[model samples]
Target: MRRHKEHSRRLPAGPRQTGPRALSGRLPGAVAVVAAAALALAGCSGSSSSSSSASATGSPQASGSPQVSGSPQASPTPGQQNGGTQLQDAYQTVIANVLPSVVQITTGESLGSGIVYDDKGDIVTNAHVVGTATTFTVTLANSTTALDATLVGSYPDSDLAVIKLSSPPSGLKPASFGDSSKVQLGQITLAMGSPLGLTSSVTQGIVSAVGRTVTEPQGPGSPGATIGNMVQTSAAINPGNSGGALTNLDSQVIGINTLAATEPQTNGAAAPGIGFAIPASTITNIANQLIKQGKVTNSGRAALGVTARTSFNQQFQPAGAVIVSVTPGGAAASAGLQAGDVITKIDDTQVDSLNALTTALASLTPGRNVTVTYTRGGTTKTVDVSLGELGTP
Candidate 1:
């Protein structure tokens, strides 16, 4: 099997036993792309093909002086060399325009990459990259001076974070965000990050899948899961590649690399490829909320504590969430949901699985009332339940 190589490095321990297994018994394609995207953002070694030649020139405006135009430089530096002279020139032009907006992010013991999103130096990165970090540092591309950064907001549920720099460098260029909803399978994509701490790594691949959901384990013993819409790609990802940019051919960011699947082995071992990235739509929603509020809180309908089981009866089987327990003043309790009842639907959405219930509640806010249909003693009943905030259980 041609598996993407895993770049050896240290990373914060991920939740155990999470992520989807590869269908081909190889590394999951999603895992490979996400890891590669993260690594590229973190600055790993990879290949690049040049297609454009444009130069950007500017100097800081004099104090109270008006902006002025200057001729563009026509030559590439020795460090800017690509495969061919012309290609190198084009690569340099693109790099010069894009590099300043990219940043090296260091949070706690975790290191990754991020992109500036606004002129105020607001940077966006994976939440896991800066998870609970007490301090953060941002290194501008082509410069070694590290700027102190503050964690402005974070949405752990969506795996997104935003940080602000104290004093941003001049000519800061924010990356252009694209519509991830339009991304299609087999579309070519590019990833940028620092993999294994190699600054400015870039890789290329195609979108392997879209609208895929992966569940990341929250903790070793915690029964919680982090589920999000993901964009799967075959791009190579490695350690330290977290929070990198996944862009389309137009160079617009469409996703944020997050987690990758490890190779399956008999004797506990780590394998390569199999990467995943949070889709840009989710990122934009979570990021906007993070920017407005310090945290992203979901105001969704409540669920009674339950775990359902599916069993076939002859030629048919009924699936639904079975109530295993009821919280002492929960909306379900107030709505007359009993311990033996099976939830069948919420509003117009069918609830055949726990995943379905969770997803259905995503569009609702807490304190909203909705009708729930259930089954008890082979009889169906409908009741009104007021929604509640998550974590109430």
Candidate 2:
């Protein structure tokens, strides 16, 4: 089977996670990616990507940015003019409505995308985009004046964060968020963000799927990131596009552009047009909590209390998670799990890698006791463990 590799949008530390069973294939190693995800969680300083300043800002030029269709359109005949005009008008209207809400976010030297979340000047973006920086330089759509922003709250578990401008510039417009429950496959969507640091850039496509299960880098459990119920779109979500808006034709924000599919077989070549976004429902719920509480209270997610990395056995092939540091008195410890023990399975699932172990644990409830299988001194052992609620550290 081909290994499945999962990458967070862009962490500057490069992609991580290779599983023999991920996406029904092998994934990248977790040892490397988890470290990056950990640093992000710790709010450690990270160098920024290419910074962008506005060149010409009235509207994105037709030649430079992304659009609904990639093919060159044929000039409309007299008979087709009416329909073409209406479609053109529709595109323009949505663009005009959504543009004001999309902004370019710069932290330290890094650049990413954001959306004005409210009249209070609060902006929401990917947690990784903000990195460890609490302050930011924000460039509004169609405007080059960079404004100051401060972090409101961040929930890296969901890879989402909220920041508020120190002061709102005049004419700020809060974007209208739509019900993600209403989103359906084949619905047209425009991805508005600063891809590759190109401010106010837009790409268009249809909702390829809804409710996709994706595991990246962030969560309550150490070195684990899992975001289920994602919105999959064909729109291009490149570097700097993180934390931007994915909108429907009515100009309603439906999702936050997050990660794109990276194919490892072709030397980490990005799977063209295959991108994922955090659904608006998750974004709305998490961002609002972060804004109000400065932290998440109820993640409603399951987790184990162990921080682990992939380890190999004598065979030198993928074995399982080697307990790096077990949260003492946490789930694993309570179940008699210890460092140096190789956890080889949970319940009926075969744990082949760190990704597989986390995925298995995520599927179970915190308080539910399950059979844990592991290897110690080259001998196999099993124990029943009562899982614990995934709580903030």
Candidate 3:
């Protein structure tokens, strides 16, 4: 049972991996714009026949004063002129209202962002941001004071954590979190964080899509959680943006900026205008649990309730996930799946490894009946298994 490594499976047609890079060490500053090397503007030079016709029609008045197609118009109407100004004003107002609720989280070697949860000094952030450090240096937006904070709890499976300030500062503004269920596509969103250590930085974009399942690549300080129902945005999510606030036009935090897709062709460079965020509902659910109990008691994610590892064939090539153990009365056990069973598929998706199994389960909910294909002894078998709710790690 070797550790499950990320096998480079061929992605469909667009962006490949949506892994959130660890912002603790040397991270990419910004999304590099790869401009087209050359613009070949192929023009149809006037043919001899067309030029002869134009010449016969009298060259001076041939085109009837040249028929200016796109002439500049008059000044815009009052409403039209003020439209952009009004939008700019809205942006400024939202920033002024919510920026103070966003804080810069700095550990010994990493930097990230957090949203002030409540006046009790609890702040919600990405678990990857906290990493293994329990203590952190937090700086409020537009404030020079560095405050000491301690970790309350971290739910790495959901990539969320809560921290408490040592000394609760007065005038701590808690951000208003909107209902993620109500977050619609095409809605304007603003991502606020300390990208590249630039504190109080903001990037704007529209909600490109909703209900996306994204998986971060496994790395040191990151569990590579496969997140579901994530809000996809065109916002530029760079390093240090993780765990930051993704807010709507109403000045409400709708999501926590988490993973950004990387261009596989460019050796994992950050793909601009494509990012995923943990919805506000999940943040609140996990944050509340962590703050109250110091750990997540119930994770809504589905699980097969089996301890497994990546299995390989005699040729040493990757095969399927092999069940090493099964929880008593768990989903796998209830379905009569025992140790030595090698899972090859879940429903329709192929399970080539343990990582693939986890990813397959991430998209499903508990209590759903699904077909599981596996190999036991020398025979391949399929069983209907009821998924169980994943427990906290």
Model 2 off-target regions past 4 Å? 1-86, 215-224, 265-269, 324-341, 361-372, 375-389
Least accurate stretch of 10 residues (summed lDDT) in model 1? 48-57
Better of 1 and 3 by lDDT: 3
Per-residue accuracy of model 3 over 222-300 as CA lDDT, tens digit each: 6777788899999888788888999998999999988887776777776678888999988999999999999997778
Q: Could you tell which candidate, 1 or 2, scores higher by lDDT? A: 2
User: Using TM-score as the measure, what is the rank order of every candidate, best first?
Assistant: 3, 2, 1
Kindly report the root-mean-square deviation of model 2 from the true structure over all alpha carbons. Answer: 14.6
lDDT, ranked from best to worst: 3, 2, 1
Worst 10 residues of 3 by lDDT: 4-13
Q: Give the C-alpha miss distance for residue 118 in model 2, angstroms.
A: 1.7
Predicted candidate 1, C-alpha RMSD: 14.9
lDDT tens readout by residue for model 2, 201-236: 889999999977677745221133667778999998
Per-candidate local distance difference test: 0.67, 0.80, 0.84
Per-model tally of clashing residue pairs: 27, 17, 1
Candidate 2 weakest lDDT stretch, 10 residues: 47-56
